[model samples]
Target: MVQLNLVKVLLLSNERTGDVRYEIFSKEGENPDYPEKIIVYREGNIGEHGERG
Candidate 1:
C-alpha cells in the first residue's frame, strides 16, 4: 500500500490578506509516473495583515 501525507502552512503579510502555502512531503521511490519530491502550492493574497479563514 502507498501512503501520502500533506502539510499546510499559512504565510501572513503586512496588508490585509495573506497567502495560503502548502508543502507536500512523500516517502516514495522515484518513478516515471509517481516521482517522489517536495511540492509547494501557494494561493490567495500575499503580504496581508489580518485574520484568515
Candidate 2:
C-alpha cells in the first residue's frame, strides 16, 4: 500500500509589492522521511539610496 500527502505554501515580497510566490510539496508512502529543504526567494542588494559603507 502507498499513501500521499500534499502541502501548500505562499510567499510574498514587500519591496516590489503586489508580488506573490507559491509552492507545493508532496510526499509519498505512509512513512515518508526526507531532509529539510531550504528556499531563498530573495537576495540581498544595495537599496536605491545606495550603500552606507
Candidate 3:
C-alpha cells in the first residue's frame, strides 16, 4: 500500500458565491478513501432540503 504525505493545504473562497474550496497537496497517487478536492458551502449557501449551487 502507498501512503500519501501531506505537503500543504489551501482554503480558497469564492467572493461571488461565498463558497469555500479546499486544495490538498500530497504525493500524487490513487487513494480510494479520500478525495483531492472538496468544496464547502457557507451558512446560507445550502438549502434546507440539501440544495446546492
How many residue pairs clash in all the candidates, one count each? 3, 0, 0
Where is model 3 more than 4 Å wrong at Cα? 28-44, 48-53
Q: By TM-score, how accurate is candidate 1?
A: 0.29
**Residue-level lDDT tens digits of model 3 in 1-53:** 54555544555566445555444544457553465544443532566565566
**lDDT score, candidate 1:** 0.45
> How many clashes (backbone atoms < 3 Å, residues ≥3 apart in a chain or on different chains) does model 3 have?
0
lDDT string, candidate 1, 1-53, tens digits: 87554433445443333354545445454333343445544454533453344
lDDT of each: 0.45, 0.44, 0.51
List pairs with backbone clashes in candidate 3: none
lDDT, residue 12, candidate 2: 72
Q: Among these predicted structures, which one has the highest lDDT?
A: 3
Q: At residue 26, what lDDT does model 3 achieve?
A: 45
Q: Write the per-residue lDDT of candidate 2 for residues 1-53, one digit (tens) a residue.
A: 43445455567755533335555444564322441332334433356664321
Which stretches in model 1 have alpha-carbon errors above 4 Å?
A: 5-14, 31-49
* TM-scores for candidates 1 onward, in order: 0.29, 0.27, 0.36
